[model samples]
Target chain A: MSDTSLTIRRFADLANPTRFLALSARLLPWICWLTAALFGLGLFYALTSAGDYQQGETVRIMYVHVPSAWLAMMTYMVMTLSALGTLVWRHPLADVSARAAMPIGAAFTALALVTGSLWGKPMWGAWWVWDARLTSFFILFLMYLGLIALNRALEDPTRAARLSAILILLGFINIPIIKFSVDWWNTLHQPASVLRMGGSAIDGEFLRPLLLMAGAFTCLFLALHLGAMRNEILRRRVAALRRQAARGALTAGGPA
Target chain B: MSLDAPHIGFVLASYGAALAIILGLILWVLLDGRARRAEIRALEAAGIRRRSDRPVDDARAAGPAP
Candidate 1:
């Protein structure tokens, strides 16, 4: 097989819950340790880094705010991919992963919005404005909530997964809008400085801490995602066992 | 880290909120994993077999014969 096919096969093999569980159990501890270490280093850099000449101490919020925003978008992207996995590939873990990620994604998005508002009150002299970027981000949070609710509202697991997958794909359209809102319109939120066509406009002193914190947040998300997926898989297993037990009881109580 | 910066409350609030939300999420996931694992252990101890734990051919043959 070609390298690409080999990689695909390996991923396909992970659809076996037992293998996935074993892999997760081995990796989760290391991922957790890495997350803690990264957060420690990231916090040191963020706290000790030089203050911005323009925003002064308030720039400190950027360390947390930017990472939360990045994770918010990134998490949704993950869900979108998982949705594709469920719909196109019929990968067993896809729905579980997408479901497992929703709460974490919602939390990050909420953090982003709250921190953004906190940053805004001081900078923009208003807690909020219906700017394109901010509004789109708010919509992203709502989309996450909607998906979570829809997942719960359906009775059949297969049906829930299918419907939610469709919704996830449909909701993905908002991501690019959130990313380019500032550029597309006159928004109070700043345009892309770190990620832009012409490269980052941020100073190195601030950039280092920002990158460090971003790494920490990314690590945190991964560790949490893996942990959540493990839990979800176990939950499914428990449900299956319960169903089997019920069947066994019915059989024993009946004519046999 | 100075206490006297103007509008510093906003910075504190923002960081506090982030810390609270992130920590809460971590705690929630951990507790949930622990709870589910305990429940699974209890179920297994009560002699309930997982679908995967059953022999495949036996399960197939025993279907509707339980």
Candidate 2:
């Protein structure tokens, strides 16, 4: 077979939950190890780097706070794509992926908020303020929670998946606002220093470890997401078996 | 690293919170997988297998639903 076709064939195989589970089982262990190693390296850099003249030692908090915030946003983007997969492509694992991503995204968002608050209290004089940047990010976090709650309240998995997909897409308007709030509004939150229009405002002194931490946290997100997907697939399998058992019981019994 | 540095407590608290959240997520995923696997094993052991797990020949022999 041609190489392009062969690759396409391999990619197509992952649409099967069993195949995806097998792939995740093989990939997750290595990703987890890589995440740990990268975090260790990143931490070493973060600790050894000299403190900022203005921010002093408190700057180290950025190593954790920034990455968590990035992951919080990235995971939601992931869900947005998974939402498309469910609505457009109708892939079996699309809803599974979206459902699995919600809690992990929520956790990361919570981590971002907690760590941001911890960092804020020292620098900004207050743990939080009703600024555009902070308020929008907080709303993003709440949207995740709302979608999670919506997913759980519905009885049928199919209906829940469809409704959650719509809600997720509807809720996605907050992402760009969160990204641009520092620019659109004169918030106390510092303007985008890393991914700004004219390149990073941060110096090389701090950028290295920040990127490493970002990489590590991204890997961590993938590791957790894959494991969660595997578990969801298995949970569905268990549910299917229970339904089977119930049907068997009904069939074996006489009509009421 | 300096214990006496200004605002060091905030840095420590942030890192501590990050560590706590990461560990919680890891445990949640791990324990959830374990519980599901155990449940599947119990169900299969009780002769309650998935329709896909049943053979096509057996399914054919059993015939259609009433």
Enumerate the candidates' DockQ scores in order: 0.77, 0.85
Q: Write the per-residue lDDT of candidate 1 for residues A14-112, one digit (tens) a residue.
A: 999899989988998898888888889888988888777778899999999999999999999999999999999999999999999999999999999
Task: Write down the lDDT of every candidate, Cα atoms only.
Answer: 0.92, 0.91
Off by over 4 Å in 1: B54-66
Backbone clashes in each candidate structure, one number apiece?
Answer: 0, 0
Error of 1 at A222 (Å): 0.4
For candidate 1, the lDDT comes to 0.92
Candidate 1 CAPRI grade = medium
Error of 1 at A152 (Å): 1.0
Candidate 2, residue A225: lDDT = 96
Q: Model 2 clash pairs?
A: none
lDDT, candidate 1, B1-66, per-residue tens: 676988789989998999999999999899999999998999988888765576898667666533
